[model samples]
Target: MTISKRTLIIYLVSLGAFILAVFYFIKTNELRRALKLSEENRDSIIYALNQRSKKMSELDSLLLTGDYNSALKGYKDQLASSDSSSFDLIQQRIELTKKFIQQSRRVVNVDSVNQDTISMDTLAENTRRPTAEEIRNYDSLSFALRKYQIQLDRLKSQLQKKSYGEYLTFSSKKGNSVHYVGQVQNGKANGHGIALLNTGSRYEGEWKDNLRHGEGKFYWPDGEYYIGEYKDDLRSGVGTYYWPNGEKFVGEWQNDQRSGQGTFYNEKGEIVAKGVWKKDELVRVEEK
Candidate 1:
């Protein structure tokens, strides 16, 4: 049978309209997806920018406060994570921090050395012989004086570096506070540095894994001090312990105790004892 012209024309027009609708729907969906993806990318970029800005602001604050250690750490972290374009700037910041730290250390070292020399001179000048009571109570008096000196030294150090405090302060597990100025690695005191304990004690020397290792000088608040070697935080190897009254012990040590061959001198610089030692006691006296 022959189809009507009107019917054929209507059917073709209807089919074209349906095809157009399907094409429009597909294109619209694709456009919506592209727009969503672009929005997500934009948000990510903004978040990253905000984070970078925050980090930079924190670094600036650390530098301004003279917290060089923290500032250096922050810069290093940034350098590790940043792109090549920022490498030069970050590296420069790291170098500047390092120089500042080195200069500060030099100043501290000179001041400490001068103070130590002066103290030694004063001790040398006191040539008065000890009385009966002074000799009998020398041990107790020396310990008390050393304790007092620790407090005094801590105060002095604080006053001297008030403006440019170039140290890191932290508290120990036992609620004691410690102020450290020096090289740090893996968040622990390492390399050369100085540590001031709240107990009126000070240590200046090499460290490893937060422990006193290698050579170092330890001072009490009083005029007593020790120059020695250490391992695992214990006094080891050769060392000298000096008292304010001009007495000194030079000897080998193990586990913080006097051991092996050693010499003990009186305030008059006379040798009181010279021999092998065990746990700080002279075991065998050698003829001088």
Candidate 2:
């Protein structure tokens, strides 16, 4: 029996409602994911800011106690420990620290202390009052102090560069392993850079708005090289790479693995290794 127009309309309306429900479910899940990521990033930023503020406050206390040396030490420690990804943010904080230090130095009133209390004049002048020509003779000391100032300026400049986009930061440990965390922008590594599992394996390459795109080289601690193309943080396209043990490969790579046609050679410059590599292993080896 044919359904009435009213009944047909009712069925169609119910189907439409079901479709809308599915759409709403997918949209809600996406929104939740976005919210979660936002919260995580917010927390990270807040934590970093709080830590810096606390350190700066400590420095202020040290200055009040007339512990300039200790205050400078604290400042250096914070500068070194700051998150590399937060170059811009940390740079602003560092500059603030510098301003505070400079202001404190100006108001230090070292003129009041005599030879009795650590010799304020000696500390301020760093020596007995020197004749004009004698002060000129202290060029070496002046040069050394200026050199330190230059280094501080350089770090400030680097942090200033971070304000533009995502960048990366890495540090080498005493054990010779590097710790990298950050992101990159345009053709540079921006944001938090990471160096994970230091087998001396490093990823120093170009990033397209934070994704690995274009050419890059992966260097192994043992002196092997993987020079090739990258897409979405994986190896892709044609590349020529050399192994640490004198083995070399020139071929196409896909998804961080060797694929398609390529050549492999041994240390003796002989065609001992030849084949298709899949997931870093040789799939087909053609003997010389």
Backbone clash numbers for all candidates listed: 4, 19
Roughly what TM-score does model 1 have, to 2 decimal places?
0.43
Instruction: Please list all clashing residue pairs in model 1, or write none if there are none.
Output: 146-222, 149-221, 149-222, 150-221
Global lDDT scores for all candidate models: 0.66, 0.53
Q: In candidate 1, how many Å is residue 7 off?
A: 44
Which one wins on lDDT?
A: 1
Give per-residue CA lDDT, model 2, range 30-135, as digits (tens).
4444444444544554454455566656664564344656766775676676556444544443443344344345434001111111112221212122345534
Candidate 1 clash total? 4
Model 1 accuracy (lDDT, Cα): 0.66
- Top candidate, metric TM-score: 1
Which residue ranges in model 1 land beyond 4 Å of their true spot? 1-166, 170-176
Cα error, residue 238 of model 1, in Å, equals: 0.2
